[model samples]
Structure formats: structure tokens, C-alpha cells
Target: MMASAGDMDTGSVLLAEKVTALSDPAAYPEFTAAVTAVETHFSWVFLTDGFAYKLKKPLRTEDMDFTSLAGRTRNCEREVYLNRRLAPDVYLGVVDLMATEDGRLRLFGSGRVVDRLVRMRRLAEDDCLEIRLKRGLVASEDVARLARGLAGFLTSQPPLGPVSPVGLRHEINTSLLDLAVACDGCFEQAVRRVTARLLAFLEYRSDMPGRDRLVDGHGDLRPEHVFLGPPLRIIDCLEFSDALRRRDPVDELAALGMECERLGGAWIGPVLLEAYGKAAGVFPPAGLCAFYRGLRALVRARIAVRHLMEEPIRAPERWPRQAAEYLRLADRAAAELTVPSGRRPSSSAAL
Candidate 1:
């Protein structure tokens, strides 16, 4: 049975307490040089002077299961293996968090292994493309360079070849329904129209084509994961699901384009697509790319609204607006897909 969208509800784990204790620089000799920790939806990352260590929270969700010690270790192993494709130097490897005889925890030890961490080389925050874009520091040349590099990376990967049609269409269908429910009458008519149209279009073409074109890819391609540097590094791929990671390059590109537009770097999408077009020698149909963009937008919208549903109480201040914005973007995407997509149109705000 398919997992409901509700499965994404964030939950805490008991291991987080242990993970927190490990975050103290005093706990480990190797981290004496630096002391800081960043927490995310499912992990804790301790940053040292030269590197970082990530410990997954013991939680099970629809798409991922990190609840078991062995499961987390496997996830860590896969995380390193898969991420190395995009950021080889940055994703060094996985290490174990072990309890020593003196009753202190240490990484890379032979004591009773209790947990694991994905170790990585750290990059400066200023080099993050998302931050650069927000600060108006990202230039056309920089984006163009990113486009070329990303295109090269995509083209270099071997195709997964024609497999059975995937469950992605069904996943999108559920996402649309979930978004409609989450919107809570926000822009009721437009959201419904978008929901209906998108569902119909997706249902009519339920069988996604070009399975032969699918590649092992970075499933999550948000701007945040992209590092704008002489040495480009894309990290934090969705590491849990094999089905999610096997994707058509165009879909991955479209997801990135959608996020770029969300971040106000609307120009980057077209430029990246153009660059990819040059490198790959062919592109997915413009209508299809538009459809993917729309789907991705709605996906984000559902995720944002989920925060309201899943949180203990008062959700983030921006959750509602963020949800609404993504819904509108989805509406625009559905509309765009209806047009002859030989060329992109300019009146985006009007959408």
C-alpha cells in the first residue's frame, strides 16, 4: 500500500539526546578545534574546523527508515556512496559512534558500536549558491558555469534503461489531493482548477515515458545543495529510496529550475535548460518540463502545509504564505504546459 502524505509528519527520536551529547566538542579530541552543531529535520551535523559529522535521528517515515541502529548505519553507508557521485571529496565516508571502556563515546573506535555518522569535508556558507542568490551575488556567468557543469554531470551518468513505468505519477496524484486539503480554502477556485487540471493531465498520461533515459541522480536538487565554487559540490541527496534516486535527467533539471524560480533567480532556469540542451543534444518536451515544474511546486506546497498539520502547536509564521505561493506556482506551471512550449513566455508574474 502507498504511504499517505501524512507519513511525512516530523517526529523526534530518543537518540537525538545522545546525538546532542556527542555534539559537544569536549566529548571528542578530534573536534577540539571547532564547536558548532546544525540540526535539520532528521539529523544533527557537528561542524569542526575542517570537516563535519552527521548523525541521523532514529525515526521511520514513509520514504525512509532510520529507526534501527543497523538501518542508520546502512543509510549512512548509502549516503556516502550515493553523494560521492556529485561531491566526491566532500563526502569522505561513514564512521561509527562507539561507546568506549571508559564509558565515553568516540567516533571511529572499536568499542560497542551504538550509532554511525556520515563524515564530510565542510564548505563555507558564502560558497552556497542559495545564499549567493539571496545576496544578489550570483552573476549570469556563475550560473552559466553551473549550468555547464551540471549538464556535464548529468550526461556523464549511465542511463538506467527502460524499466517498468514508475509510481511517480501516483505519487503526484496523492500530492495534489494533499495540497487541496492543506490549502484550507486559500485561493479556493484556482487551487481546485489547478488540482483538477493537473490530475487529469497526469492521469491521461499516467505512464511516464523515456524510462530508458533514467539515470542514477541526485533526487533532491534544491539550490541550497548547490555550492557555487571553482570546485562545484552538490550534496544532501534523498538517500533512502532507490526508486526516488532513479530518475529522468529532465525531471531532475526541472526540479532545480522550479526551485531557482522560487528563490527569485527565475532567469537561472532558462539558462540552465539552454546549457543542458547544448550538452545533451536533446531535451524533454517543454510541456513536459512545465508539468514537472508544476508538480514540484505543488509538492513543496504540500510539504510546507504539512508543517502546520504536524507541528506540536503554532507552526512557522511563513508556512501559510509559503504554501500559498507554491500553489500559485503550480497553477502557473499547469497553465504553461497547455501552451506550445517551443519557446518560454515572459509574463510570469501575470501567472
Candidate 2:
């Protein structure tokens, strides 16, 4: 039976109550000094002294759906299972948010299940690679260690299938349209040229390099999701779509390199490539790396600009600058596709 409008209102109030309760330190099983609620695009993370609990919003987007209880539960389970690949110790388990007989909500309460949350051991903020990079605390050795770890992990994965150049082109076209709408057409021509050059590079090779090496990998590989340790921990694999998560190892590495350069660690990019090459036993072509990096940069720029499309836009002042910066990086990387003999461009090319 379809829920009446009044019933939906009641459900919303219940959700709000649950969220408010989760934000309270008293709702936790142990004594928490405080609870800090951090909101992201898809979920709410309630941070405590030693743990973080992620609750998915009952929302649907183009790529994901968490609008039903069953869907959210399934995603919660998937989040823990997939993240365990790289951060086994961090993703603890999933817990239910329940409503009490007295119409109160609480975590793990013995009553009707109202929602689900993914529980995790909170990582140190200072140990995050992004934070370390920003503080100028990341060293070449750190990058080397990360590269070795990532290379071993990536090489061990079984190949899912081959990448389709036509499919990728379609994705690029969709993102270009998205960018045009998001940035008021400011970057339409520039991005079109960059994407066209990328297609040319692929066509010139006849066979797309590394197309058959796509694996179910960590989809989001920014430094922010990487923890720097003697034993590194990476979290937040894109848990929604298997297709999106399947990617060439080089493409993933190139995306990470692009992010490192964006974070003011240009030296880190080259060091990562060298170490990963030695570990993986095959150096990726410099031209292909450049192409992947540029492609990722354009995607990232679109993502940054798309924040404006969200209701109650987050950091309204920041997205434009971020999008412009990524566009700059994309342009620089696209230019490298034209270098003769696949000669690697200098890492110190000014951003």
C-alpha cells in the first residue's frame, strides 16, 4: 500500500529524531565526550572519541539509491565488505538504529529497526595523506611506501574485463554537458578541445593501452581517503556501482597522481610512478599516463562545478575556484598528449 502524505510526514519526523539522537553523545553504547556530525554528499557521519558511524540519507541520485530501508541496509553491508579490502581493521560492522516502544529512537535499541549505520574505527586526522601533504609533512619515502602498497594490491586483483573507448567517450560527453550547465558554458570549448585531443590520442594508438587490465579497484583514490602509516590504510571505495569501480590500474594511479599534484605535491606524482613501476614490473607509457590524468582532471572539474547544482550549496565560494584549478591541470596534462615520442613532461611544470 502506498503511504499517505501524513504517514510520510511521520516517517520524516522519525528520521529526524533518529538523526538528532545519533548526534547526541548519550546515544552511544559507551561514554562519549562529544559527538561531531559531519555531513557529506550522501551520508551523515557521527564522529565520537574512537569511532565514526555513517548513516545514509534516504535519498536517490543518478548513480545511487538509498531511498528505501532495504536499499540502505544493502549499501551499508556493501560499504563494510568492500572497505574491508583495504582497511579491514577500520570497518567494524553495521548496526541498526531502532525505535523504542515509548516512541524514542536509539542506536541498537531493542525495537523496530528504523535505520542502519556503518560503524568504523576512526582514523587519526593528522595521519591522512591529504593533511600531511598540506602541512608539508609528506616525504618521498612516504610516497614510495604508498606506491609499493598500492601496486601490490592493484596487481593482485583479477581483471573484470576490458575498457570500452566508446563507453568512455560517452561518459566524457555527458560530463561535458554537465560542466557546461554548471559553469555557465565558460569551459565548454576548452574542455571539448581537451577531450577531443584525448580521443585523438586513443585513435592514434589503434589499440587502447591497458584496456584489458581493468579490475574492481578502489574507485575514489584521493589523498584524503589514504592514511599514511607503516601499514597504510585506504578507505571509502565507491560502494555503489561495480561498473564504476572497475578500472585500469594505471587509470587509478593517474587519478591519484592528479590529486597529489592538485594538493601541491608534484614531486609525489613522479615518485609514485617510479615506485609503482618497479613493484608492478612494467612501466606505464608516459603518454597514456598523461592522457588518463587529463581525463580524470576534466571529470574532477565537472564534479567540483556540479556542487553548485546541489540545494543549499556547500562551500558556495569554493567550487568555482576548485573547478578552475582542475581545468588548469587538465589543460596542462592534455598538452602532454602532443609531446613527440611519448616523452614525459617535466613534473615541475607550474600549475
For TM-score, the strongest prediction is: 2
lDDT of each: 0.74, 0.82
Question: Candidate 2, 235: how far from true, in Å?
Answer: 0.2
Clashes by residue pair, model 1: none
lDDT of 2: 0.82
Superposition TM-score, candidate 1 onto the true structure: 0.85
Query: What is the lDDT for 151 in model 2?
Result: 91
- Candidate 1 residue runs with Cα over 4 Å from true position: 1-13, 31-34, 108-110, 161-166, 200-208, 311-315, 339-351
TM-scores of the candidates in the order shown: 0.85, 0.91
Error of 1 at 131 (Å): 0.8
Candidate 2, residues 1-351, lDDT tens digits: the string is 011121142255445566798998878887789999988878889999999999887777667777777888999999999999999999999998877788777785588777889999999999899999999999888988999889988999998778777666766666677776666788877777776667667656544555568898999999999998756999999999988888888889999999999999888877899899998997888888898888899999988887887776889999989888888888888888863465432322101
The CA lDDT at 78 in model 1 is: 94
Residue pairs with colliding backbones in model 2 are none
